[model samples]
Target: MAHTTSHAAPFLSRAGILVLFLAAQMLALTAGAAPYLGPEDEPIRLNANVTVTGSDVRLGDLFSGHPDHEEKVVAAAPAPGQRMVLDTDWLTNLARTYGIEWHPADAYDRAIVYRSGRTVTPSEILAAFKDDLVTKGMPANTGLAPGAPLPTLTVPSEANPPFSVREAFFDPTTKNFSAVAEFTGPEGQSQFLQVRGTGFNTVTVPVLKSDVTRPQVITPDMIVSAEIPDGTLKHDIIVDAENLIGKSPITFLRAGQPVHDTEIARLNLVDVPVLRNDMNREDIIGENNVTWLTVDANTLPPDAVTTAPYLIGKSPRHIVAGGTPIRRGDVIAAQQEIMAVASRDLPLGEAFRSGDVDWVPVGEDSIGAGVIVSEADITGRVTTRPIRAGQPIRAIDVTRPTVIPKDKLVTMIYATPIMTLTVRGKALEDGAAAQTIRVANANSNKMVLAEVVDADTVRVVSQQSAMR
Candidate 1:
């Protein structure tokens, strides 16, 4: 019985091996017939966003797990520059039909599709129309005026879209034109726009290349030419470059605009003498203080001094600022005598010395009648009022030094043709040298007129002369 059981076990093993080989063959046949589902662990995922430049949207644009049939077209793409959203229901139906192992995890599962595109600007369209009009017997220097505003267009993004103008018609007599503008995409889609405008003859006018301020001369290098409609030209508009060059703007001028004759003036420049530094009143203007500045004659004040000779050796009537043109009224001619001016500040009762004042040439019109002109007139004299430095001194500002004070005892001298006598007296009032004052005799208390000769002496006048 044990030998029989061992033989039966070997036969059972051979039968089991035959069944396993058949099952493997069946699995291979099933895999070849059905679509390839990737490894069991990795499931298909829905893309949240998609962008396409082609006419149709493929499966690969909405799912990421399948590659063998990803190029299969599922739906048409939206128009250029437009977008569309696919809901979860539409995505589930598409996945089941394509055998993609994907299911919406939530109701929010969706994909948004956008077709890339670019805008054709109005200016670009106008440029194409202009080129077409030129070939149709229009002038090369023609400016276009559109009857209606041109519309901007949207086309698929292409490196160089095929833009062209066709069916262009122009009437030379009427100066009117009409054309069809078209732009084509890479996928054979196209857009057409109609354009209508009038063409007019244009004239080239000189314009400033940059903003120019007043008093700045416009040179050839600062100007460029621009074309404008000839009908828009006015009588004041300057067309020739010769009129703009070597001219100065009256105010400010902007770039790329036509210049007007009234806005600019012909340069009639003259060099006028100006102060190199500020000059105070009565300050003399010398060659070193003068500078020459070139300016437009029209901007100068009337009777403005233009030469250095007119300003040199002159004093200002008032304070004049530097770097400004001097006018005839602004300055005075130094034709009067030399006058004494305080070299430094002088206090009241301070005696004047030679070094205390300076002799300077002064204008007669600027000085008062009592102004001192000689240093000798002020020397040894005391100031009655405080005097500032650089100010002219008047006769009333100083007086002779006081030599005697009131109520002081002084030696009084009485002299005749042969006899001379001296007496002690008291001064009745303060007296300066060469001034006469009344004195009282200290012994008899008699009053007598005396001339002060020194600090301690007074000469009594004769009775006959004192009575007069």
Candidate 2:
């Protein structure tokens, strides 16, 4: 073990200080007597670009100096990008001014040469870029978003180059900024780089007021709103305090932590049915085949069917597995019903009554479009063909209520303001009640438009038009 102690800097006596001053004065006089007779100093070897590390730099360190001799010549740190030469003549003049009695050796004419001593670090480049943004009206708190790229500072590793910010453009619409930087080396070589970053704005949002180690229900009083600078927040963050009420966290939320949408879900949920057994295509679902489950309403799809009535009578177009969600595509409408199933089956040419046909819902698309008959359209109508109880009603199964038969004799009445005349006529086309059709008058053998009144009777216009 070694002893260690602290001490102050050693102080020189007043007599010793005067002795040093007189010795320096005597050396200056001796140096003036001998014009070039002094210690031989080698030339200082400096690169084209040199970076000065400190303010007080000894001039003797740059060139060869004796180990025993003291050098009093000092120089201040040079500014960035300042270029200058330290040739033999310049060095000699600097030594003369400082009373430095030394000269460069005859064999070496050059002393020290310096071109540029600028050290542009990555941090310095970034600071300058930020300063440029501030001069152009950027906010003090403005910065790059998390994970944003750093400035592309590609200065030479071997030398420090002069750097300047050429342009810093910002676009408010896109919330992005770009910068162009130019770097010049000592030998006049130049380089440029373009850097970009996304701009973010600081905002205030509600945060949990206390730490929650386990998943707990959130309440309005448990949170407080605060302002903070954030660039990594998700897009669907919950910023309002009211939105936090009656919500349960999926994970633990620490105190003063900002609330996000993914962390919590609303406690209010709706109960919907899920299939318990596999449902085949066109199979009508029943109440007993499904089980109810509670799910968050926000998580449900917009077209999700929630009620049992919507699925009970509806038929599926595809097979639905058990435990799967019952959606729009899994079910078909229960509007298609068979007419004959409502009543006892009727034979061909039998008149159909409201009680004679059944309107039971079926799980088939056999009824073509536009041809589906409703109860009002089929009441008191006769079926043209044999009817099956479970078969869907078709257009060909029923005929129109024909009041007049084709090619049949009919009484055509011609009425006038004063009197009415009746004549025999033949029906050219089958006509229903109040239907207009062509009828040939038996007496004149001329076809005329007439309205069918009954099964065997028709009426013409006034006597003036009927006569023509």
Candidate 3:
């Protein structure tokens, strides 16, 4: 039994040793199969959003919690100012390829990658093109008109990226140009664009600083200089400051616009007669009552009286206010003559008295020939015909007072050298004192020429005496 027990002990001991060795080997194999943990043992996770500035997108941009191989490039980055989405399948394939310990949570899981950059403005591009053009014999301060609309360009946001023109061609004769513009990116990458346009020389011209109304004088302060394209300048445009200063605008002039030669003119001034003081109708305006005003002829009324001679010795047709410019219809020639006119309607055979006539002043052209101008000539004269009130009395309108009416019985007296005879007669016609008229003898019924003596008396005269 001792011998069997000793032998079994050796076998059992050897078996235990082999078991311990195998268990140790199993632990070594398990440990070798498991993943290694670092100081930061967080799980690898998929990033939902990411932004990149470089041209390449790396594993670090699409996932977190992995730093050892995060910089490994996974894909090309999207263009500047653009975005790309990494879906679950793409993310899974990328992770497997790069050995990243990350997986999408679901099929809908995605990472949106955006590239940050800056847009090159149109003005910046133009300035670059212009600089290149200037170096290529183009005129300085030249204006440009693009042939077609320029395309938008974007570059990585860096500190003042270099923008330049390459392969530029310009024709001084035709004023045409074409060039390729290049923008250097942050990584020394370049973006090229084709540009084509026309060039024009500029000219500095005088422009109005403010709006001016018609007849308003333009002074030096109202003008300003501005640069304009030479092609836009017209032949009649006023370019000199001297041409615009002290000139009046023919019409309204707008600000910041070029003035034309026809738009401005030398001020034309005229001396116009104006009333010095208020005057009523029929009041004479003499030299003392009028004043001359210098006014722009273009702004004056068409019928305005500009001469002082026209206003002097004239009377206002209606009440005129002071400082009012005299017009052709406002005044008439002043009354300069006195003429006899009827104060009231005078019937035929009615004699005019002091109260029946008016001696009024009239213009020289108003009086006619043979018009009685003296009040004495019309006071005691009888009207030969009916005369209206305010009508002038003429020589044919009035005559001496009638001493005997027609068909009236009158005493006819015949007077000779020493003999005087009286007889009853009838007047054949009306007669005034000393006027010759026909009378008929009542007894003989014979007509004889007689001289009117009184209201009821006539003197018969022989044919020889009448003729004398």
Best by lDDT: 1
Please tell me which model should have the higher TM-score, number 2 or number 3.
Answer: 3
Shift of residue 365 alpha carbon in model 2, Å: 6.7
Ranking by lDDT: 1, 3, 2
Question: If scored against the real structure, what TM-score would every candidate get?
Answer: 0.45, 0.32, 0.40
Off by over 4 Å in 1: 1-128, 139-142, 147-195, 200-204, 221-223, 229-231, 271-293, 302-403, 408-426, 432-451, 455-465
- Candidate 3's C-alpha runs over 4 A off are 1-140, 143-199, 211-214, 250-257, 268-271, 276-283, 286-291, 296-313, 316-333, 336-348, 357-373, 383-399, 404-468
1-468: candidate 1 lDDT, tens digit per residue: 999999999999999998999999999998776755555636677889999986789998999878877899999888667899999999999988987878798999999999887888887887778787788778888877789988777677752654778898788898888888878653556667777889888988999999998789999999898888898899999999999988899999999999999999887898888999899776888899998888999999888998899888788888999998888999887676788889999999999876888888756766678999877678779999999999889999999887999999999888889977788889999999988999888887788899999999999984633321
> Candidate 2 on 1-468: residue-level lDDT in tens?
122222222233556788999999999998666533225644333222334433333555443433332244455534333434456776677667644555666534553323234455555665667678878887755654423445433333334334778788666777687886787533336767677776667677888888864335677678887655666566777778888887877667778878778888755567888888888866778888889877666667888888878888777777888775678877887556553352566688787765676566544564545444576666656778887765656657776578898999999988867988788989999987777888888877788888989998898843334433
Candidate 1 contains a number of clashing pairs equal to 0
Candidate 3, residue 111: CA error in Å? 50
Candidate 3 lDDT by residue in tens digits, 1-468: 999998999999999999999999999999765543323767777778998977889877777766766788878888777899988898888877766666676789999999888887777787778778888888876867679888667777652654667988778888888888888654547768888989878887898998998667889998998767888899998888888999888878999888899888887877788988899765888899888777678778899988888888888888888886777998888768888888899999997776888888876555789998876676567999999998888989999898899999998888778977778888889998888999888777788899898898987875433321
Worst 10 residues of 3 by lDDT: 459-468
**After superposition on all CA atoms, how large is the RMSD of candidate 2?**
26.4
lDDT of 2: 0.66
In candidate 1 the C-alpha lDDT for residue 253 amounts to 96
List the lowest-lDDT window of 10 residues for candidate 1: 459-468
